[model samples]
Target chain A: MLSPILEFFSSDPKDKKLKKAVEHIIGQKPSNIMLYRLAFMHSSVSKETVAKGYKESNERLEFLGDSVLGMITAEYLFKKFPFKDEGFLTEIRSRMVSRESLNGVARKIGLDKLVEYDGNRRTVLARTSMYGDALEALIGAIYLDKGFQFTRKFIVKSILTQHFDIDTVVSNNPNFKSLVIEWAQREGKQIRFDISEEGAKHNKEFTATIYVDDDSFAVGQGYSKKKAEQTAAMKACEKLEIS
Target chain B: MLSPILEFFSSDPKDKKLKKAVEHIIGQKPSNIMLYRLAFMHSSVSKETVAKGYKESNERLEFLGDSVLGMITAEYLFKKFPFKDEGFLTEIRSRMVSRESLNGVARKIGLDKLVEYDGNRRTVLARTSMYGDALEALIGAIYLDKGFQFTRKFIVKSILTQHFDIDTVVSNNPNFKSLVIEWAQREGKQIRFDISEEGAKHNKEFTATIYVDDDSFAVGQGYSKKKAEQTAAMKACEKLEIS
Candidate 1:
């Protein structure tokens, strides 16, 4: 059933420069061939050519892979940092999976070299974060070809443990929301942000106060109550640091 | 770490009568132990006991498992019904993963008999649907413990291939949102819901209209515009019988 799709990979000969570049980036020989093809398949390529009758582009795989990546990352962070609370875990994962980080990885991996497109000039802007998404789609393919355990190991060994520093990265770039949530949880606190007045109907300003076990910690204002609380909580964290 | 947890499982054992009844229903010995256990762990259980100090609940795992399940089911449906389009593939997947269908599976497996509780019986309703969530959680656990290949095989053999009659099921159950989206995609339709209306400043009512190549297919009303559009889309699907 997948023979035609498999043929697409073998028929398209890899350029020497592209192969070396991919080897340097991926840190391993491309074990599963389908993933490499998927990484290069731009939406610009006619969908009919990619899969026999698959209608949508790699968007669905990207979505699926994004969630898978998230789960594996979350689990990794959870086990790695045993003492870290949910807020900390969430922040770290967010940082790891953020568009900026993924794009950086994509660029580092030189994914831009492998992408197949119709026009060279027009495809310049196409190389941006779409490469990161393509990278994830490739990961999804690897996961399908090789099992999850192998994929998980490959992700950690090849990507995270090899390229990134876990502790320094997390400690230096703390998520404000996570810090506040962790502090609250640690102190057995209950915080609520009540928007007493929104200045305008269309574009409203919200006032939020952080409560630690019903006592007000700090108050802040923002366009949204969530933002306001986050600001308030950040201020409280600062205050606690001083105290 | 798991001894205390295992005690909870051993406390009730499986009610002999219920076991016999389930065996009669399933026509086989339930080989998947972790899956059954996962189907029983309600969110109500203290987070400390589940993963130890981490608030690592089943929610994240459920989210990941849901996507995996969705993709696998879509692939199955796509191959099984070669004549069906993208819309048909999507609707069948939705039907397979719907909360109601999962809940039904939970009932069939007698998962309700295995749940551990602290006996907060008054406010919280302990229904079989919770088992569906646990089922997803268990898949997460299996992915962790066994691997994705095992999980995939378990799902295919135990659930999809054996239990579900795909043709009859898909023909009977049609997902409205999926139908509308597919129809829009195929017809080269551009649809947007104009939600400019603001009611009583704070409160808002949104009206949504479905446009198929600039023609309105249906109109829907709701508290939020996104909701309204979804409702309208659903209505359009019903009217057109797009599924």
Candidate 2:
């Protein structure tokens, strides 16, 4: 029962280019045809087939893949940076899992080669998050077909260790919010955040004040509290001349 | 610095009787300090840590964990239930990660034992999503502390396999949206979703109609697409006696 369904989704074995690409990227012959199919299935096809009580898209797979990626990424960070605390680990994980990074990885893996679409190029172009979404879906599919261990190995070897630097990436990107608070407490100062007004309602602005005991030493404003604090901290760092 | 901090968080080692209860329920030693902390870090923590230099709480962690939990749960369903398709996998994952399920886990693990606040308990009670939020944060922390294999082992062995069955869950809790769409299409129907009026400009009410070709089978209303669809779908489901 599953054989013909698998055959329907699988690329022809004779398609040398796709086969080679799959072999190079996945490092083995494809065993799970439905996963590959789900990775490339578009929502339009899903909508049509959904009416027939037959699911036809990668959305579910994408949802599954997202978790797998996060778990694998978290695990990798845990072992790689044992000395770092939870806050430090979290910042690094955020950068690694950010939409920009995920999209970059998807493009590097030549995922564009496998995309099956039925619309104008503009339509595909408009759906920018498609790459990241599909990549996540593919990871979900891989985990389903193979297993957690295999998925973790594939993610570590293919994505984390290969494409990104562990230390340089994290250390350079310290959490500004944490730094600002640390500096305030160390100098025996009080800090105030006034999110009174800035930006539109959807994008509000915040202003932060760093006071050394009784006097305000620095002030900064930005779209988010973290950004505002970073600005304020950078200003205070200059005034304190701690470096 | 780190040792003292660890001691401060983990001292008392979770009361012996309570620990035994948690072991019987969650089936593991507390995975890591951050997981325990996150389970208690309420949004009321004001988003700024004097030591950490930021005003953000575990909200971001909760966001990341929510998506990650969804993905991993979906993959678990996919592998465990080979006969089940995308819809079934989605339904099972939804149930596993639902607010109620997460709250049940949180209560079982004695998350309330670690809260650090002195506000009206009713205010805390109102935010039902907090339970799921804490659960996700715990997962995120575990992934950071333990790594992929251990985290996977913990989640699968401790949570899903121990507490629930995938097939029964999916068969019982069919997604209302999917069911409605399937039924509408089978009966040769068209659905129209219209935003009739918005409340306060910020909060909006949407109306959705499930039409059998041209005849309206069901009409429902809500504040968001998902909510509106669920309402419409529920109406259609009850009308058709599908479940």
State each model's TM-score restricted to chain B: 0.57, 0.59
- Model 1 segments beyond 4 Å from truth? A1-35, A47-64, A81-95, A118-128, A144-149, A168-243, B1-39, B47-95, B118-123, B126-129, B163-243
The 10 consecutive residues of candidate 1 chain A with the worst lDDT sum are A46-55
User: TM per model?
Assistant: 0.57, 0.54
DockQ category of candidate 1: incorrect
> What is the lDDT for B149 in model 1?
68
User: Tens digit of lDDT per residue, candidate 1, span B60-152?
Assistant: 556546555665565466457644433345556667777778867755765656555446542444543576775665556555555566667
Assess each model's interface with DockQ, reporting 2 decimals per model: 0.13, 0.14
Candidate 1 lDDT over A141-204, as tens digits, reads 6566565676678788776786578877776754456777777777677866555544346445
* lDDT of each residue in A89-205, candidate 2, tens digit only: 555777887777888888899886676654544464545677777788888778777877788889999999888987677667644556767777885667754434543455455
Q: Find the 10 residues in a row with the least total lDDT in model 2 chain B.
A: B46-55
Candidate number 2, chain A TM-score: 0.65
DockQ of predicted candidate 1: 0.13
